[model samples]
Target chain A: MGTGFLDAFAQEYKQLLDSELRLLVERLDAPSIIKESMIYSLEAGGKRIRPLLLFATLDAFGIDPKNGLPAAAAIEMIHTYSLIHDDLPSMDNDDLRRGKPTNHKVFGDAVAILAGDALLTYSFEVISTLPNEFASADTKLKLVIEMARAAGTEGMVGGQVADMEGEGKKLSLEELDYIHIHKTGKLLKFCVVAGAIMAEASQSQLDHLSAFAHHLGLAFQIQDDILDLTGNQQVIGKPVGSDTANDKSTYPQLLSLEGARAALSNQINQAKEFLKKTGLNTNLLREITDLVASRDH
Target chain B: MGTGFLDAFAQEYKQLLDSELRLLVERLDAPSIIKESMIYSLEAGGKRIRPLLLFATLDAFGIDPKNGLPAAAAIEMIHTYSLIHDDLPSMDNDDLRRGKPTNHKVFGDAVAILAGDALLTYSFEVISTLPNEFASADTKLKLVIEMARAAGTEGMVGGQVADMEGEGKKLSLEELDYIHIHKTGKLLKFCVVAGAIMAEASQSQLDHLSAFAHHLGLAFQIQDDILDLTGNQQVIGKPVGSDTANDKSTYPQLLSLEGARAALSNQINQAKEFLKKTGLNTNLLREITDLVASRDH
Candidate 1:
């Protein structure tokens, strides 16, 4: 439960995730602009938290986590795509992401849009093409189907629509939860489930991991809401108050800053509880929960 | 085969495909706007050519064509998503499609974009979840991989970029070929290959189907270019000369109208010849080729 250990575990996955992503792009043999735009957003460097989640969960099962490398990279691609599309002028329209130019800002909206589209397609391709020896075709197909569902209309994209339509409206906590769960929760949950499935964990273990991820995802969003309201723009990599500026609702607005903080803590503790119930050596997962709970940026 | 026979064959698949698409959207249990936008595009009625190609190819092999319904619908969704994105303001900026307002014009840019994303993701979900009786997990995985390749940057999106960048430039036939092959050809080719794979065709059969599809796709594009120049706007569901209006290079623009016409005929013939090589009962596929070569609209 030390920063030293958490940093080391996370650092390993980040390097693997980053190198794999770059190689994935390099091997595409696509036109220069499309590849450049994709690589730019991917290599821009986020926290690599999603991959860390997948790797950590796989690690807890004592599986050779590298076997899940493609799937982890695929999840990151999906995350990167959501970010690119979310930053489009028609959507969040931010000029900066990760302290660099957003995809559309540098590549133009058309290329940026296509770049996101390409990555989305590539994600499925990556997972589907993983070696069938360790990862059976059935397992890969399940991963692809689950990832698609999470990323599809009733999940991420649907949540996006709900979020957009809710702009300028005061949303009830229930409505906000719907958006938060679908928007970010589904994919985070997928990261945890992906690890379990790849490790061929039992259904009981999967249920536990899924519950752990659900709370982790909610905590992640609540913390995001808190940071948007109170954190430093330099550290957070974007201006605070964007939600308020966009006339959208957030946990801090609906639940109050103190209420949001309490909710975050509750969710983090719940996540840890679920992890503990799995009866697996999840020390790394526990540290991640702690990192998510108390991180400043 | 008689036109009556072709129409009946096509009519059966269209109804099945249309109903399945509607049911799929209905079952998504998504928010209203996303559902509304997706159904609007899915039901807009664009000949369902991709699905028809899939069904026709599946039929030729004596495989139960209905078994491929999910995949056929998936292909159509990918095609629809491309059209939705292609017509975006930053892209072709078309206001009309199939004699109706474009998705963006109907639902606003954000919903249209997300609608497209939803459909793209849903396509894979549908294919991956196909009944185990119809397709082995290995077959499903291959379908997912090929679809991704066809839809990703190196295929459709890459073709679109090459197209957008090629605008207003004087392009040779070789350059035009590259764009058409990737943009329209890749997906079309996938339809053929998908059916073959589902039927577990031999390698020689696959090669023949691939070749057939390549010619059919090129012929399809040439005919589209011709229609852009000479067809009625109302019949074609958009203004004639939109391609030229956008300053895009086309077969007719680079090869003279007569030369383009001849090329179209040649390709259609080649497609038919390849089908003959497959030694499958491909009467329906041949008819589809003729439809491609001679369709005025």
Candidate 2:
């Protein structure tokens, strides 16, 4: 299952994301330092989970994944921008992300920050550039609105603010939930919803997909928290226990390791249940679920 | 005439920008340090040129100034993000902006970068959230698209990349023009176009407005370059000659001071001619042109 699923998924979806990213980055005029900085981080290796979920969600609806490629790429751009800014000296102050010096460390802080800004704004341009493909104008507009919301104040940014403030202080479980939901869950939900929007999924399908994404996101964050405590830095490609060093509130800090583990299991189960209602090719989704639950890092 | 125009412009537009900014900042969820950092830089005193253009453009079209408030505020948000990121230690490394410690200095780099990111994303959210009074969904979407273009790789960011690359190097006049047009002209053009969009102007009116904005933007940037060389630090609220210190290419660097003055005069004249074709209220626009040409800083 791992080989088959990974092979098929990587073959199709990863290629689509890579092609889209290449096209997008190639559009940046050649040899401009900030553009180079943007391209470097954007092409940096990651699992492409967000873009894959977007493609998979479209596939589940029997829509051609190609139809959602722009949106998929756009979301990835937004995600990359978030990661770039998150690693800035003023933020996470990290030297490495994905086994390379962080964008700021490599490109200088100004260029890194501007590149992230450029990427974030370009995501919208990518979405807007979709040429009458998949979904009505209304749907496309709504997708843009949703993407903005997910990436903006009420979603990831809001959660980041909460996370930054909640550091070095204990947070109630509810507040922690709020932070995670906005920070991670919102964009994850956008991946699903944006995919559904591209596919023109029924409202019912959207609702289920949203729930699925929410649960999956919770599980994903919990797993990350757990991995930060237990995973090797070489494996994770980032320093472990940095969260602890920052005194950041995490699932483990709030729920204890066992409790966090249980929460992850519960969320994974809920995600699986939600996926079941979609009645689509659930193999990859299910595998990802199991992967989320058991992954060491 | 100069004093009265400045006073009236300040009274009418500054108040609106201030109120809109306050309301926008107040909408952030409380107790978030990142949000506070965002608000700090956003509220820090500056000339508010972008928002002024937005408002003035709307007024020129006889649209209620209040109707353009959201877009005005959103433009300012984008501008604020640029300033915050530009002042980062890795970027321009400026400790001060607008006579205050830069956002990174005041809030730390991490929170400041995040705050800038948040504000950049939030600008779109604010645009998306504009009440229905602004225009139809299609028009709003167009505004979003225009803004995305201006802020993204093809516009402001592209120009920034070129500017960064051109540092300490002699650039041709054409290259300097391209850099300034992208870095400053694009957003300034967006401010005007956004107002015209909100007012639902005719295609011909939009054409004229576009022309007006394009030249006005060039004029504005030229004036900025001149001010950097000749203006007082106290009046300009930033260190004069920093551009020269950084060996950054500018219009004046490519053109002799006399040549730079000629270009500014030509652009302002073109801007006035474009406004003449529009047949809109020319009072504010005329004063703006004059102010751009004559300002010491």
Candidate 3:
């Protein structure tokens, strides 16, 4: 079940990221409700895939993954914030995520929305305030710039808006690609690119790593589409077919299930090819790409 | 009617800030609704007090206000985003802002929410990616860290949560101050501290400027509470008594109108004392403080 190195890395990081995240929010000295709402969502937990991707990219670059902890946590906070907002009643109206009641379901829409904002805003603070030992101030600035661009209108939020407007309408493959690329791919690409940036990877190296992430993200999304159709609710955490219920267009819905699976395989292959071109140690990166391509959840 | 220096500076920067802000969003190749929602709130406009404060602080420290344009615009974006979210149905539920329908009323809830998110995220990008001449990466990094701390849970968002939780409870003056300081003071304080930071002012200067901002912010909030009690609907751009109608606490509600006025006067005086201590070219900052203390809308 485990790709030995990847599993070991993830296991070590999950606890570190989790505890660090717990301390970050706990130290806020904020109102109890806001903290509770934030913690509830944070603690409900997911696969920590974004952080792992960040760590893998660092590992591939021969950078110590531990030094990237703040950036790792920052990206995960961003990923988590997006999930919280996406599950809002006005958005997906989702009641469950990660096998737990959504943020809004438990904390009410107002606090949930605020909790999301807090997490999003705090992510930058965590990164921006990192000591020079982690990364130079300039490097941190680049990370912040890249993160904001990826998470802002040109990225996740814009993609979310497009997703909302496109619901109940059949979306073309091009349109779906826009949604997936900006919605999910941009930040995923950021994960790898940020790792490269932190490690002072050259432009050539950054480009290859970015290309790897672009394909990996698409492959991951396609796999998610497949899992929604084929995976059990218990395994997937949320109920299956929720996308269809929300009138969302998925790859499997646009293409046949077999076609979607083929797309996934193609994307994964492209991702691996890019990794190979990076000409760096990519054992963890390759295994994670494989894991993403095959994960049921 | 005008403090000559403050008025000229405000007029100059207001146009520059507004038009620059317009161009920043215009360049974003985002989806229409999201862009529309963001611009609607942004262009609807307000005092632009935050930007003016940024410029005034720079002017005081003998730095080119033009050099601060990106940061000024960034802070305004953050202010606008906070307004958009604060006006959402799930939040303050206001339908009017700057004499126009709120973002949610114009673009619906989801777009409004995402637009706010987009604005907040992009603000950092604006600062982080500023050309090297305007500020160093370390300075930009500091600006981002300060902005996030002021705008995140322990600052505006936390204040917002407290505001929500305290509604209808006839909060004590101390409780009300907590909301005002976190909700309004933090960001206002950032406006000054960020300017000094960018200017590389001496520690003594930064301390005096921070103290000035602290008092000015408290005065500003007190005046807002007063306006909600006595100002015209058309002048204020929103209904008077909405705060009371929502059963929220205010300075006047807790301390009586006369007491609130006395408090506002005291705050303004304290602001001036700090400014006098700075002993820098802070005439513009002092005038702006006076303006905030007396502005009708």
Candidate 4:
């Protein structure tokens, strides 16, 4: 049952993301070099977790998931850009991501960097072009603000900086939480909340979704840590123990494996409780949360 | 008279930019390492050319420049982010910008890269937050599209790629034109067009501003090429002959000094003619055009 939910959700979201990315790239004008660079990494596969959460949140509000596609695409674009830059020779210096040669490795460092920059700027273009299917300008603007906050200084970028600065050093639980929340949690929150905002969900509903997403985000990171430590390279499709090789701190590094497992359980419970309050169909969300905690990779 | 215009314009724009940047940075949530990286470069002094162009265009339309502050700040944020990324060791590898260490040099490559990402994301946030003081949602959305096109694959980034690929190799004038227009011209065009769009200018007015800005952008870049060849480090605040050192093909390299001079003159004439059609307060815009051609650095 869990595998069924994961496979279905992943496939549907991937199809949606692929279509949206193609359409967005098609809208570019004649010059094709930069466009090709951008398309290269964007099409490079990753689990479309962020966009899935966004669409699911919208669906919970009885909103058509199509209404959330632009935001979905924009968040993925930002995510892909971050990955491309992070994998640069001067950064993580990784030559592979998801079992494929990294963007910089394939396109050269200059093209990879420019590709990241282009995608970051193009996300705003996606948000601004969102059709009037939105309930109000105020709501659309709110979604934009939420996304910017999530992606900007106080959010993912901040997290990445903290992670960089903290590498090869032991970090307290509080410090680690700070890094994860900003770096990964914020964008996840934006993914969920942006959908709710687009659908004009009640403030109360939004609050619940925020809580649910926050916990899920933490849970997601913890799982990533676990997979990094123990998963098979063939299944994970990225190098295992790469974090250890870099001397980066992770939940499993800070907390023992048992403690990390306990924390994961706690977070999963919090996500479930928050979702229950929404009184919406959360069967898929619940199953995904379980999958997040239980997946081997 | 022209010198006075240039000095006052530069001074006023600097002041406006300073205040806008302060407000923008102030909005960041408390104490994130990534925000620090962003602020490090954003506050470093550079010519506020893009924001100044935005404000000047707004001023020409009889709009209170304050109404356009969000757009002005947003454009600068985008420009600053591009500069930050461009200076990375993986890209242009410049250690200095505006007489200060580049962000990557001071903050480390990862932080610098993330900082650039933060600023790019924040630019859109600034735009979306424009209160009803600017215009309707449709108009604001239009501005977003214009800015995105200028910054994205088919615009500035595309130009940069062409530039990198064409480096050291001899290039036809058409290819060089392609690089300059897309890389620099597009964003410059956005500065003028976005301002006019916000001011609700007539279609004809927009067309005039567009043409004026197009020529002005090309002229500005050509002037940069000349400065790269002949200007002092103290005056330009960047190393002289850096382009030649990098084996970059510039206008001065592609066209002889005399040819470059004639091209600059022709562009200035075209820009002046376009501004003449607008019949607005042309003094500032006209002086700016002349300054582009005559600037020593």
Question: What fraction of the reference interface contacts is present in each model, in order?
Answer: 0.87, 0.55, 0.92, 0.78
Q: Which stretches of candidate 2 lie over 4 Å from their true place?
A: A1-7, A229-235, A238-249, A277-284, B2-10, B238-242
DockQ-best of 2 and 4: 4
Q: Judged by TM-score relative to the true structure, which candidate is superior, 1 or 3? A: 1
Second chain alone, TM-score for each candidate: 0.97, 0.95, 0.96, 0.96
Give the runs in model 3 whose Cα sits over 4 Å from its true position: none
Q: What is the number of backbone collisions in each predicted candidate, taken in the order shown?
A: 0, 4, 0, 0
Comparing candidate 2 with candidate 3, which one achieves the higher DockQ? 3
TM-score, prediction 3: 0.97
B56 Cα displacement, candidate 1 (Å)? 1.0
Candidate 1 chain B: minimum summed lDDT over ten consecutive residues — where? B1-10
Best by TM-score: 1
TM-score of the A chain in model 2: 0.94
TM of each candidate vs. truth:
0.98, 0.92, 0.97, 0.93
Model 3 lDDT per residue over A53-104, tens place: 8898888877889887888888888988999998999887889887688999
**DockQ of every candidate structure:** 0.88, 0.52, 0.88, 0.64
Best by lDDT: 1
Give the alpha carbon lDDT tens digit for every residue of B1-297 in model 2: 465875587678778787888788787764457667877887895777777777778888777778887888889988888888778777778897767889988888777777777788888878877888677777878888899999887888788777777878999888888888898899999988998888888999899989998999999989899889889998887788978988888778778778888999999999999999998996776777787788876
lDDT of 1 by residue, A232-287 (tens): 98888768897788787999999999999999999998999999999999988888
lDDT of candidates 1 onward, in order: 0.91, 0.82, 0.89, 0.83
Report model 2's TM-score to 2 decimal places.
0.92
lDDT of 1 by residue, B125-160 (tens): 999988999899899999999999999988999999
